[model samples]
Target: MSSEAASGMDVDGGAGRGGLTTAERTTIAAAVNAVLVHCQMASNDANFKAAIRARRKLLALPTTAQCLDVAAISDAVLEVCYAMGCGGFPWATPRWWVKRRTGGTWEDLRQCDDATDDYFKEKLRMSPRVFREIQETLSPLLQRRVTFYRVPLQPDHIIAYALYRWATGETYDSGTCSFGIVRASGITMVHDVTAALLTACPDKISWPTGLQKAVVLRAFADKGFPNCHGCIDCTHIYIDKPANANGEDYCDRRRRFSVQAQVVVDMNLRVLDVFVGYPGSVHDMRMLNLSSLWVRAESGQLFTGPPVMLPFGVRTNGYLLGDNGYPQSEWIVVPYGGLAQHPTKARFDNKQKTTRGAVERAFGRLKGMWRLFLRTHKCNMDSLPQQFVAVCILHNILIDAGVPFDDNLLWEVGPDGVRRRVDLGMHQPLRPVCMESSTGDALILRDALAERMIAQ
Candidate 1:
């Protein structure tokens, strides 16, 4: 029995679920009693009760207000803004109001706003607005493969509501649609979007280059790495406990709990593929093996043969770089030793270490660019990895769109020809592995890097 019920709280006495343990019952009972007390406290204030009654009457008689069309629904969404703990400031309020009240979609609202296109574009691209966008986009993409259900809020709405809660650490229902209109609009939840983001890569797509790639790709080529795809690695994102028993398995190397995701981005720093939702307990090597992505490549289901060359000059064929945690196979390469040094193995060690640098640079640039990713958030465990995928897609979009920053103009050159500005990312030490040194190890390292580059 739950501890609460064991204490004789009888929390579930009224519902009579009977299955609840004593502790569960007591906890529920306490929650019920707390709500009742709050209601009584509010009732003691006559004016507050009267105002609530008046609002209810007004809400019941809503057909007259033209603002009632979308505005009423917008107001309902705004109600969620408060529930989600987005309650601190006046302006921090959800901007969905602009689009909803103005009777326009996120894109249309962007055009009318005085804010920079990038600003509005980014806000609209966030989960709150992205859910709406996905619904519109998916209807055409899915066509008839899956049945679409219309709820008071659709799947996207549920997914958005859950994501808003996860991302903002806000109360549940922070992004929900109201009862009356939810059924009308037919909100598709985000899980469907998650599925798409994970599986949507067709045989090919064009990827663009960013500053990170400009540096690393050239560096790899200069060292003679041929057909070298970008680096591949696994990173962790924190997640709340899932209801499943296997949920705990997601805890990873940092020792703190997280879900693991593997990403393969090209030399251009565009993510070519993502293998996510692995349990943290699984080692990186095991997770990589389990992924259908690798299986397809090995079985020749993808790329029609062993090698997969991405559009941005990133190619994956017989080799992929891995850390010492993984096994060194003909298809996947790892360090010569497990972080253990030996004079005789120096050359092999240098080659593996240098070759792995490209992937590290991509990851460093990725985390540095997205401040949110620099830290972690508590997310609904099942959905966390999918959210990561969305972020990756957004990152690529930003790079390709060349989303300009206001600060870019701050770097104008002076009459003396010295530019005055700071671009932190421009000089953030090309990842540790990419750093060059004149130490005694340089010769051995240089040759090994050259050999790997030629194979690339």
Candidate 2:
């Protein structure tokens, strides 16, 4: 319960849920707010706590309204605001937002918390545990030191506001209806939450290191690809034409304006590395070349390891599997093409396809859980990249937590009006040309793997 409603003063004779209707609560809140007018101006700790405590009392109990000591209230509110880091005239000045409308989905928040986590999973796309963990993690950052200028929204509500918005891909106005927040506040909160999550979970989307690399190699070895680290793929994210961007540059082969995200995923479909915010018109190779991943992998910084012995007495470093759309390199291998009638080549193609599907499924699970990725977002290009990165981190976080994606959320109506599972390539542009030549040790190792597969 909120501090204002903490007193639990009900206009009702204890018949209502909290003994006070939303309106009566707001009325009491207004009286309580009066006592905070001087909280920011308070000279010392005792006076400030006393004033804040009095305000809490006003909202907590079913009480008759009385004229508050206005002078005392001003000092208290001012001191509280200053302590809150609200330094300026506008922020530190006493204000009452108690009249703001309430009672939306937030009205049932207590019930939702009290009930089973099924409600949380369905409504917010996370179990109560995951939600609480996130809330607790972000609480210290989201919480203000004081509420002298205005009552602050808790981290709990902020996270719910952002996660719900992402899960449903709903409009800003929907937050007003669902969370009873101003649409602008909802937008700010989502951005803030995204930033906080990114800060909190920076390691969620990272390259496998040290022993982790060995685990990835062994997983791929089981699939007949020795010394493999991960598979890479690119998918588009549809968005409105961002300001100051050439609209045509954002248009993909499918003619949709989008920003593309490139992902590298391990065998479990966990994101190992991610790079996003390229224009959709950019090809896969170009996107990779432009990314820090390309530089890292090329510098032997990404796949650092002692060489693994191949079946042909060959020893090589770890590499990633890619489709023909990607150019082959020592650090990455692409599927063979031409003269596919050969059983050996066909076998290699099949095996490569099997392993490469991990990245595709990674994309599927990502968009499946976060419907925001499926929608044409209005997030600015500057913020778009972080939004994608943050979502990817959350995706990996949930996977680490053993949270399951609701398959029902994965269903979407296509342009033909047929409802189906969300496509991994729903927003992907045309595939890069197969002419991207297989080159260097990547070419040699791929053939060796194929022949070894035949031998096995």
Candidate 3:
């Protein structure tokens, strides 16, 4: 029979014409077997149907050859199998192309020997050395959780996916496509990586003590806020409106939905402590009051020493520089608010504002580095806080790695002293009750600091 007649009859099991030649029969069997194996089809009927469908689809495409061969048929079948969630081509696997394109090795996708240091720093917001270190640190902890039966999700892939999500705030589907992870796996990777970071990197967000506390104090002193250990402020991180009954509480004064994150940062713009998950409507001071830092400071556990003697015999505990949103206390210092400010008070306010800017700089760097915090994050309300804390951990990591802060972006503090995006208009009128009554000793310490500054 003619080749065309033979090819036509081949589909009908070669019943109407001479049976297919050995080579033709072998090619058809191979194509069917490939569909069965790659697509995981259980029945011969399903495998044959998939192979025929794939062949027809390829023939219908504009770029396809008018006639097909065994290799072409196998390629078409594999493409369809992959699309149907069966298996992936070697070049399309995250273990293969993602590593090779990003300058990693084929044998070990995590290695960075092929990439320059700047490539990792710019792309991953970490140096190659840091990435390697983190990979090693997290691998043991994450291996069991992140691995799937079909494929083992490497620690590098998990870390890269988390960093990419934090840096861009992209959706899970986007991440899957970018990182070669499936949707469900991508979500799990982010969750597992975030938990791993929080578990393994607590020091990054710890309270200062001993030599660390002394170092922080000295750094703030150099910025003209004497005996100051850190700057305190709260900024709103936008989030999707929760679907719960109390979702309204998440709306901020600006009428936007958000969650408040109160952060304390040292002069180096490293976050020392972070309290997150408060609804946006909560006042910054209220959030502060609820923080463990506040609890520790009020209980006298945060700092222990004879009251630090300042110039002119003023005695005070190490204090945090805060904006008007916070009340001045033995451990917290706020700027002067009255219309009639003494020259000394004005000078003090000036220095206080300048010094308190460290927290703003810290927030700016945080959002700028992990832009996921800038916009309304599209994550479950319960998971949002973990995401925020995860980014803060990464921010501290980058700071420790000496990644320069992006100071070009400016954030504004409202009249009530809460930090908000600059483009959001002025805050609601300041409320007197928002400023808790200052203690006699707290007031006296402020006056003494002001007088001492003027004297200096």
Candidate 4:
């Protein structure tokens, strides 16, 4: 742009009294027009016609209007500058991307906040307190700095959008309508929220240690399982068939497309460990062996605490409880499973069932709270695992906050939230399963633990 053209829009939309002079207008017009004419925009560009009309309007503005508004004059000239730099006209912001400008989604979301706590639980799968805690916790990582063009969504709002979507399992299209956002922005909101949660999740979930390990051990001992650290279980997260060659592997005993998650939960139902991303067809024991937990355990890195002496001279440092889905190990105790169950073993199985109910109850509550696990997932296979882990972290967070679970929530939550499809372009081949039940120290530990339990 020429000095004359730049000077015409001087002082931030302020101009001298009276309209621009005929000669000054002529200079500005010629300079701006020269630039606009020479700039090449694609012939098939959506804004091509709008650009032509903008040019004609620029050419027609009366340079000699003595009473012209300075603001109008500035806008007129800058509009062309806008067109030259940006492919669209200055006013041509994409309609769908900018839907929440005024009395739209943001206001509606605010209005949905009634004084009671029920609204947040139903809408976000959590109470207001949990929501705020998460908002404050994720703010540092999720909050984006304001750019000249747009102010980012608040951490609170992003978390709400993502949580509500997960809790309700609504499709993104309908979710956009509910939230007053366009599909693209809604999708970005989920991504931003998921990323922040994942980054913070590792710290939220882990095996019991220090003071926590003591509390967990005492809690389980009181429940009739001595030296028990926690319980482990597996559940399936249903999904739509993948749009890939190996999509069939995700199908399981239910013959549904899904993935498996191996969760180890403490007595209080907080998720201590998570291993997900396997096809739903994989056996439970196979999933465990493939996990980092298994690697840590097999390397003698896990259960390093001092041993607890049991009946019959048996001892275990600490052990996890599981159902027959997993064979017994020195570090894990599973029940006897033959036609003629011994009275000692039968009595122990009853206790095992009761204690291991924590894992089953944990899965029930997890799926109940996060409707994501209730229905077939619509996200990428790779994305589903991270999102599952993220929600699990939230599960532990809510538990720590003393948020009570209402069994009725499962019946009350509405249809699934709309999910926009994501393709991370990754694949998993079915991993093979099983080692014969160990007759060694694992059998001795089980027998000792069972005998110890029946005696109690």
Best by the lDDT measure: 2
Winning model by TM-score: 2
With a 3 Å backbone cut-off (N, CA, C), the pairs that clash in candidate 4 are 168-417, 169-416, 169-417, 170-416, 170-417, 170-418, 171-417, 171-418, 172-418, 239-377
Question: How accurate locally is residue 339 in candidate 4, as Cα lDDT from 0 to 100?
Answer: 63
Tens digit of per-residue lDDT, candidate 2, span 1-456: 643343323433254354555565567557545544543454466655654675565455333332132233333444444444442233534356543657666666547445757767766777888888888888877875444445567789888888888877888886787787887788788889989988888887888887777788889999988878898889988888777889999998787889888899999888988888889988888989999998887787876777877766667778888887776667777777665358888888888988888988788788878888887868767877897888888888788899987667768788999998775553432344554464555667877787789889
Worst 10 residues of 1 by lDDT: 422-431
lDDT of 1 at 38: 47
Candidate ordering by lDDT (highest first): 2, 4, 3, 1
Off by over 4 Å in 1: 1-114, 121-189, 192-220, 246-248, 300-317, 337-355, 364-386, 404-456
Order the candidates by TM-score, highest first. 2, 4, 3, 1
The alpha-carbon deviation from the true structure for residue 121 of candidate 4, after best TM-score superposition, in angstroms, is 1.4
Residue 185 shift from truth in candidate 4, angstroms? 2.2
Candidate 3 ranges beyond 4 A from true positions: 1-116, 145-149, 406-436
Q: Looking at model 2, which ten-residue stretch has the lowest summed lDDT?
A: 63-72
Our tally of clashes for model 4 stands at 10
* C-alpha lDDT (0 to 100) for residue 92 of candidate 3: 34
> lDDT for each of the candidates?
0.47, 0.74, 0.71, 0.73
